[model samples]
Target: MNEKAWENFIVKNQVSKDIPEDIVMSWKRSVRAGIRPDLKKAPQILNHQDIQHIASTNLLHRIFSQLSGEMEKYFNKYDISLSLADEEGRIIASFVEGQLKETLQEIRFYEGGHWNESKSGTNAIGTALAADKAIVIKGAQHFCENWHPFSCAGVPIRHPLNQKIAGILDLTSVNELFPDNALSLTAVFVQSMESLWHAELLQDTEKIRQEFKTYLKNIKEDDVLAVDSSGGIVDKFTKGSNQDIEHLIPLTLRNLKKGENKEEIPLENGTDVKGRIIPVKRNGRMVGGITHIRKERSLGAFRQEQNSDSPFSRLIGQNDNWKQVIESAKRVAARNMPVLVTGESGTGKELIAQAIHEASDRKNHTFLAVNCASLNHELAASELFGYAPGAFTGALKTGKKGWFEAADGGTLFLDEISEMPSSIQAMLLRVLQEKQVIRIGEHTPRSVNVRIIAASNRDLKEWIQAGKFRSDLYFRLNVGRLHLPSLHERKTDIPVLANHILKNIDNQFQIDACAMEVLQNYSWPGNVRELQNAIEYAVLYARDRVIKEHDLPGDLLNNENQRYSMGLHLVSNEKNRQSKETKISEEDQLLKTIEACRFNMTQASKELGISRSTLYRRLKKYELQV
Candidate 1:
């Protein structure tokens, strides 16, 4: 392709607006083949029949099933009604609308029906397969003139592991109904479907994985063993064992070098359900072993050591705003300035702090946490600054080093600092300014070196104004501010966190894929904490082996937006709450701003806009198209 043609191709691939022509051409020449084109995924041909077809595919079936929920707002986003077809035009899954069910049944778009090029006459699905490339059948561009009323865009969904053509992600929409968005929605859904497919493929590998998971799940507290390719025990979590390592693990990697996937075996205690050994095959050889140590049939909590791409890992969608928040946190963590993390209670301020500390220089030191709100009046003052003998009533006989002293060479995390009494706020400020603190009831000051990480879900600006929190203290903590994206704002992180949790806890401990889907669509009101609790509860209540939808927490299932709908509106989560709290009504809020700008549509729209169409569509797929 020439530069101009390549440029157009590049412009088409990007979900954004026009790009520099030269840059576009450069990208096209760099690579083209095997890259799934976006044109194939548009919703240009969405219809009752389409939804019915999509509802059938295992990929879409699982994807949309997880999306089965109650939420007036999210209903239109998934619409979970799209019909997909294989290259040969064999109808897959679908969510057939009631009104069109009769017509759809008569047409060749229902399950097991065929719509290939030979049958339908050279269209998106058939042509894409024949040409071995994505194609867009624009309004009136259909090879069959009868299809002129609808436009179709389709890209072939390739098998994840083999990278071969699997099926087509085709979006059929009415001509001219934001045709451009159709392209984007198709692509986004296709990507999500692809991600689901990859996860499904991982299930095939689970049989091998189950070997270790089962063995580990039933293993005694100390019992450990490593197994080789044929499921033979190789080693344990540790070397020292009264029992023989020789009898346990097979002699294989003994001659191999250290760090060569060597096993670390835990001592054996009888009652190990059965030690399961899974081989880590590399280049056709069983290079190492992964052994699971299970004490109970129940699933365990996610041990961060294994950060697999599990369903409970994280809730990350295709939203730019939340992505920016994550990016901003990393940048803020790179500096030493005190970071004020603001967000809803469950939005993970502590997780961000932990992430920041792990990325900073003082990482090697102990991370000391002293909740200013958790301490009582007597302990609050002494807990922050070490106390000397007789410093106060019931003080430690000798002097006890406070959090400041304990975190002297490290980070002193102050959670809910706004709750810190006014008396101690003064001392905290002094420490921030002088880098030292005086022990309670002691005249002498103790020299301390610590990076103070303070956080609060409350608005300090308001507290400072109300005289509840000190202004000077607020300024100290505000040096480096990091605002966390609320659950609704970064809804994408929901899936990311969910997957992280599941991979860490579920898949290895128990197979609860269906329950994971339920967790994915849940609106975590308490943010990460609520999600953690729900999963923890489900892990415990799970009977019949794996956690299913019935095993999920009652509160989560009954009320999707329980947290947001209920009161606790913290600073970050309350951005919307604040607007709702202050604004009299939706129309009043919009009209007032528009009228203030002398009814300037563009300016008024800019003042409050992700756009009307955007707010209406929650698919994330639709936003990408826009």
Candidate 2:
């Protein structure tokens, strides 16, 4: 053929009508691999044991054994040879007749010969496997000059279970003897093999699933679940009570490796369940897994780990605003009335909630916390009210108990109440009023005895007025309210809080006077959470155990405006002004301060010398940025 013209076409990267697209692409790949058109032969060959190893380890070899006779008889008329190659394109089996078999053997087209595109340039087996499609490489289309005398047709064989290419099926003959429909025939055979293999795999999976179910039945009256690697439940069995098996496990549970195991899994009901994971292996590789749930036992309590001295004591502050809020919380916390704690983000709403739970009569019971903003409307509803079996698509066959049931006789802290969807807000109102929760898809409402502490950074009153929240819900939630002060409103507490935060870190850190001043001066828009973050950042980067002004965030330095000064004087101005006109002017000044500080409640509270929650109330009263 014309090497010069092909090289020119490759150099110009032009497509030619004479060459098929697949062949043209293969030629480009071969050229890029530094292959020469005059190369005498393809490289690489395996010994007998290596070929036997590949055949023994894969299902493709078994399938090939059944196909060999039919393939040999059909290609005998054309004087062609049929070959089967493993995923790596090494010939593991072949069927040939007479002189054509002899011709193929001379060219190392026998068992143990490798034919990958990288080594063999371009041949039917290699290129077909590489592209994962059936194709024919005729005469000069083959890259190696030695292969130019033959026409080869091949198709990739894929395993039906995992959809991975298991091998390649090929038909090769001298150019004159190549059949007209060789490529199509090979593809049809591979498809049939894959279908048959899939049927066998399904049978095996069913048998194994039945074995697992029987094992669970013999061991205990519990559930056995099998999940594929993709987190889809392949099979499940529920014994004794005959209730459907429930998969109340996270998708992350599917990531358990072959040997890695989880001994204890905590359920929403504050009970710990013992389980063992059995990894399913095929050919020494993890394909899926089965989980056998043994039994459920109540633990002391199941709460998220907290970085606090004691629940109430950790709600630290020496200021009057802090003192008043704490006193009010302690009084009503024992009363078992529903409470709503308001504050800016990171201003310790969760801390107060935890403290209330600890100080209340139900201190020893579970304290469950849920972030309303983190979940969607439907999910929030289903999570808080539980879901009956078949409530929605992909729902667990067995029903699930919601947070209300799980936190019975304890406390349920719903954070970010302002972000709760309108539909969920209405449901919550009913739950609070009736003291019962109706699970999705269930007509009956179950009674729940749980104290709720709803928290929000946003003003729910404004949300109600805006038609984004229900006023009735607001009224029900407003009974026992405590608004936490922002760090800016209580600047005097910063030094103490800073020390407490630093002590938690293992390393000793000394704050330079300038850095301390920077911490105090900057308006903490993110409130206490931002302060903790800054301290962590400084502690991480502190050189010689000292935090300097330069070590602080650059935003803190540039944040100095009239508003920053206002934060320092907020308390004094409030104390000095008692007249109605003065109050109106002060309200405008507070508005200006908040706007100047980018409407961050914590920052505005600090400038106004008020609590973050108080600032939220004011924002609601004026309907400004509500």
Which portions of model 1 miss their true places by more than 4 Å? 1-319, 508-522, 543-546, 560-626
Whose lDDT is greatest here?
2
TM-score of each: 0.41, 0.42
Task: In model 1, state the lDDT of residue 135.
Answer: 67
Q: For candidate 1, what is the total of clashing residue pairs?
A: 80
lDDT of 1 by residue, 1-626 (tens): 22233334445544123433333332343233222222222122345556443443235444534432321222232222355666466656544455344433544445565555544544567666655666666543343334544566777777666566767766654554425665566666667677876775454354435545544443335445555433344345542333444444442333121223222333345323322333443212233455433333333222322332121123333467655666776677678778788878987777667767656766545577777788887678788888886777776544677888767656778999889999888888899889888888889887888888888989888888889999878888888787776665666556566655655576644535445544644566687778877777777887765666667788755553342222122223222223456435444444454455565544443344322221223224323221
Looking at model 1, residue 390 earns an lDDT score of 73
* lDDT tens digits by residue: candidate 2, 27-76: 88887888766666555488877764455445567667666645645557
The C-alpha stretches of model 2 lying farther than 4 A from their native spots are 1-310, 560-626
Model 1, residue 178: C-alpha shift (Å): 95
Error of 2 at 528 (Å): 0.5
